[model samples]
Target: MAGWIWRTAIGLAAIIAAGVASAQTFPAKAVHIFVPYPPGGGVDVLTRTLADVVSKNWGQSIVVENRPGAGGVIASQAIATAAPDGYTLIMVASGHATNPFLYPKLPYDTFTDFSPISLLASSPNVLLVRSDSPFKTVADIITAAKTKPGGLSYGHAGNGTSTHLAGALLNSLARIDLNAIPYKGGAPAINDLLGGQIPMSFNNGPESVGQLQAGTVRALAVTTATRAPFLPNVPSMSETVPDYDTEVWWGLLGPGGMPADLVAKISGDFVAALNTDAVKERLGKLGAIPIGSAPAAFVAKIRADYDKWEPIIKAAGMKAE
Candidate 1:
């Protein structure tokens, strides 16, 4: 009996060592990073950049799958249900932090169901108007909205998107009512803005950086605590309304149960990738700042945002419409 027990112990030890060795050889196959927004959006762009560099460095291919709907619910749910293998991951936007409050019941728990890898970058939303519009600045929009409630409108990806929340926060802060118009995604909303269907919209910096430069759209203010590096001339919305700020930050995450060593590998590699000169230059052109923040910091930001917005969203009477 003693000899049999020793043999079983030795076999178990061998299996444990094998598991550790396999984990060390991470990304032995093609890895897929799920992007919750549609193609051409900021989150999509960030993920594609990281995947390009990381795959090249590891000598393996990385695929990015776009799943857009329900303010990212479809994609979030898919990632949540996927196997905890490190092969499947996601690059989430600010919507990930806000969805828990905006949606009454998400298909998955944002914190408990996922492991945060790192915050890749953050893109602030800028309030914009058509180039030839009479409104010279953000105050003009506020005054116009106040004078004619629901007369002024803004657009977003959907009901619970960061764009939608930015508009809501603006309304709450400025004490005005600028009705929100929902679109399937930012690309369409931006399309309508350029077509003059919507007067003004709070869109990400990269989405409008080109149009702004082309003189197609005129920017009034950005929704960051400070002016965006891309739009140095554009003032922050908070400059007019105290304590008012909004943005669409993005980060990488994975399905729960990733081993500590594997998680370290992913977080370290991506952070290093973000700092590469090529990656930095590309991000700068898009008007985005590459952060490559820590996993704990990312998790903490999500939790803090979840707590802060629950009451605010509830008061705004927002739903997934």
Candidate 2:
């Protein structure tokens, strides 16, 4: 009996050692990143950019699988159920933070069940309207909404989206009853605004910068705390409503249980990719500022944002589409 017990213990120890070793020399093959939105979106843009760069660095192929539905529920769930190898990762946004509150139940937990790699970048949203509209500034829009509650209307990418949240925060801070109209994505929302179907909409700096310059739409304010570097003249929404801010940010994450060494290596290489001149210029044109945060810091931020956005989502009666 003693001899049998010793052999059994040795076998178990050896198996565990092999698993750890395998994880250490991880990504011996191709890796895939799930982009939860359609192509041409901000998250998709950055995820593809990282995919190309990371593939070269790893000397292994990297794939971006776009699974667009339910405001990221489908892709997020897929990532959660996948094997916890460093090769299986996802690029997520603030939707992951607010989903818990917006939806009654999420297929996965934003905090646990995943390993945070790093926060890649963020784009400040610009409040835009037709250049010929009467509302010339953020204050004008707020005053109109307050004076006539439930009268003014705004549009966004979708219900419970970051842009919708920005509009909600604005309504809450300004103590107005601005109505929100949801579309499948940003392009449609911006299109309707330009066609005079809606009074205004919140859009990314890159998406609206061209229209603003072309004299198609006027930028009222930015959601960031201060004016955007690209649009230096427009004041931040915070200037009018103190402490109010909202924007879209993207981060990289792998399923939980990735080996520490492998996680550190991938993270370091991804950060290095951020420094590349081509990537910097491309991201600049998209109006995103890169942030190469540590794994632990990214983990803490995911938790903090999940908590902070829950109440806002619940109060605004946001629901997943």
Clashing pairs in 2: none
TM-score to true structure, per model: 0.91, 0.93
**lDDT (Cα, tens digit) per residue for candidate 1, span 251-318:** 88888876656777889999999999999999999989899988888998888778867777887888
- CA deviation > 4 Å runs, candidate 1: 1-23
Per-residue lDDT of 287 in model 2: 83
Q: Which residue pairs show collisions in model 1? A: none
Candidate 1 positional error at 245, Å: 1.8
Clashes of each: 0, 0
| lDDT over C-alpha atoms for residue 160 of model 1 | 74
What is the alpha-carbon lDDT for the whole of candidate 2?
A: 0.85
Model 2 C-alpha lDDT per residue in residues 189-279, reported as the tens digit of each score: 9899989999999987667767877899888899999887778898899999999878788998877776666677778888899879889
Tell me the alpha-carbon RMSD of every candidate: 2.9, 2.4
Q: Which ten residues in a row have the lowest lDDT in candidate 2?
A: 18-27
